[model samples]
Target: MRKLISESFFFCSFFSLFAAFSPMTIHAAVKVPVQQMGNKTVATAIGATRCLTPAMKSLHAQTVKQMEKDMAQVDAVVYAKAIETYQKKLSMIWSAMSEPYCGYGSRGMTAVKSSFNKSVNRMRAEFLAVTKTAPVAKK
Candidate 1:
């Protein structure tokens, strides 16, 4: 009996240690459709634009132009493939963020709106800082 108890204790300890060290995976609370996520992203971007100052908007345009130029340097096919992958990853992120309120109704929608506003505010601050210190292109 004592031997059996010792073996059981050892097994429990080993299992507990293994579990403690195991990697944890996080999952989204709800599964949002890709189409819905896309729509939400577009709406969010449009709403966010309203919060940007004129200078920030100009900076954003310049940044986008520079990015497009940089992308153009890459092979067309390769850039297209990369963009596809990027879009897929972005969609996944948006879906995850939208998961919580997927079908919850008005309260869930309110939560989503609150979350998007918070995210937009954070992004706006970051963009403002970037625009303020970004270097001007030499003619």
Candidate 2:
């Protein structure tokens, strides 16, 4: 009886300690409602466009010039590829952000938003990269 009790206590203590030191994920506090998510997407897209405005201008000028020229297929191809990547990233951002968690809604939303932001940032970066403008360079 004494040995069994001691063994049980040891096992319980070991489990407790293991749980205490185990890696746990902390969630975000922001809970974006579903309707709000759409608004957020639109707002973020607008913000992204505004943020990339100068770069967009440069790209527009370059693209116009390229369009006027007969041998700008490479530029078109590059633009298409970059745009495709940006679209894919945008989709990923939305898909990841749309996960719904009952108890961890806020945390999940935060994680999703963070992921979405990263994807948007990457897409913006790719746009700027293709445009080759320094105006949108990170601060």
lDDT score, candidate 2: 0.48
Candidate 1 lDDT, 86-136, residue by residue in tens: 345434434544343333345644554455445444544443444345355
Predicted structure with the largest TM-score when compared to the true one: 2
List residue ranges in candidate 2 displaced over 4 A: 1-78, 100-111, 133-139
- lDDT for residue 22 in candidate 1, whole number 0-100: 63
| CA displacement after TM-score superposition, residue 106 of candidate 1 (Å) | 9.1
TM-score of each: 0.27, 0.31
Residue range with the least summed lDDT across 10 consecutive positions in model 1: 42-51
- Please list the C-alpha lDDT of all candidates, in the order they appear: 0.48, 0.48
Model 2, 34-96: lDDT tens digits are: 335644743222112211235433543554353334224335554666556655655554444
Cα RMSD (angstroms) for every candidate in the order listed? 14.5, 14.6
